[model samples]
Target: MIVAGSPAAWLDRAGYHRIDSPSFDLSMDSGFILDGEVYPGGDLTIREARALRFVVP
Candidate 1:
C-alpha cells in the first residue's frame, strides 16, 4: 500500500505507468493523524511499482 501525501511525486518516483483503482469515497471520519502529520484520506493501493525510492521530508 502507498500512503502518498503527494501522489504525483510518489508515482513519478515509483515509475508506475498506470493507476487502476476502484471508485471509492473518502469522508472526514476516515481522516487520521499520525504523530504530528495529518492524512486526509485512505492509503493508495499500488498494484505495481518499480525503482521505488521513498524519502521523508
Candidate 2:
C-alpha cells in the first residue's frame, strides 16, 4: 500500500497477527535473522536479506 508522495511508509504492526502466510518464519519490526542468524550479521554474502537496516549485509 504505497502512498503517492510520501518518502516513507510503514505498516501497522498489529496487521501481522491478522494475516495468513505460509512462511514458517515471520519478521516483526525488524528482519527475521535478529532472532537468529542463518546468514550471520554483517555478512555480505547473503543477498536475499539483512538482519537490520544499514548493516554490511
Candidate 3:
C-alpha cells in the first residue's frame, strides 16, 4: 500500500514511524475476522466486501 505521503514526509508531520506489511489478519475480541489483506490497519474498518466502480475508468 502506498502511504498518502512518504515515510519521511509523514514522520515530519505526524512524528511517528510508519509500519508497512504485505499481508496480515485482524481478529477482534468479538471474534470478527479479516483475512487476505494488505494494509490491515486501513482494512480494519471494513464491515463487508463490495466492488467499487469508478466512472472515469
Candidate 4:
C-alpha cells in the first residue's frame, strides 16, 4: 500500500485504475492523531457497509 498524506489522496495519486478489493468503504481511510502526525484507522466491512448504506440511504 502507498503511504503518503491522507488515505483519500492516496487514491488520486495511485496512478492506476480499479483496485481488486472486495470492499472499499469510506471509513477505510481514517485515523486518530496521537501527537501531531496523521494515522490510518478505517476498517469497515462490506456487509456492514451495505447495511449502513441501505438504512442510511
Deviation (Å) of 35 in candidate 4:
0.6
Per-residue alpha-carbon lDDT of model 4 for 1-57, expressed as tens digits?
443334566577777444546565556456767589876777644532344334554
- Score every model by TM-score: 0.23, 0.16, 0.31, 0.20
Model 3: how far residue 35 lies from native, Å:
16
Q: Please write out the lDDT profile of model 3 over residues 20-49, one tens digit for every residue.
A: 655456544443334744342323442444
For lDDT, the strongest prediction is: 1
Mark the regions of model 2 whose C-alpha exceeds 4 Å error after superposition: 1-17, 24-57
Candidate 2's error at 38, in angstroms? Answer: 8.0
Candidate 4 ranges beyond 4 A from true positions: 1-29, 42-57
Model 2 over residues 1-57: C-alpha lDDT tens digits?
333433332444433223333344433443345445643333233234446657585
Give the winner by TM-score: 3
Error of 4 at 34 (Å): 0.9
Clashes of 2: 0
Q: How many pairs of residues collide in each model?
A: 0, 0, 0, 1
lDDT of 1 by residue, 28-49 (tens): 5487776989877656433444
Candidate 3 residue 16 Cα shift, in angstroms, is 1.2
lDDT of 1 at 16: 62
User: What's the CA RMSD for each of the models?
Assistant: 13.0, 13.6, 9.3, 11.1
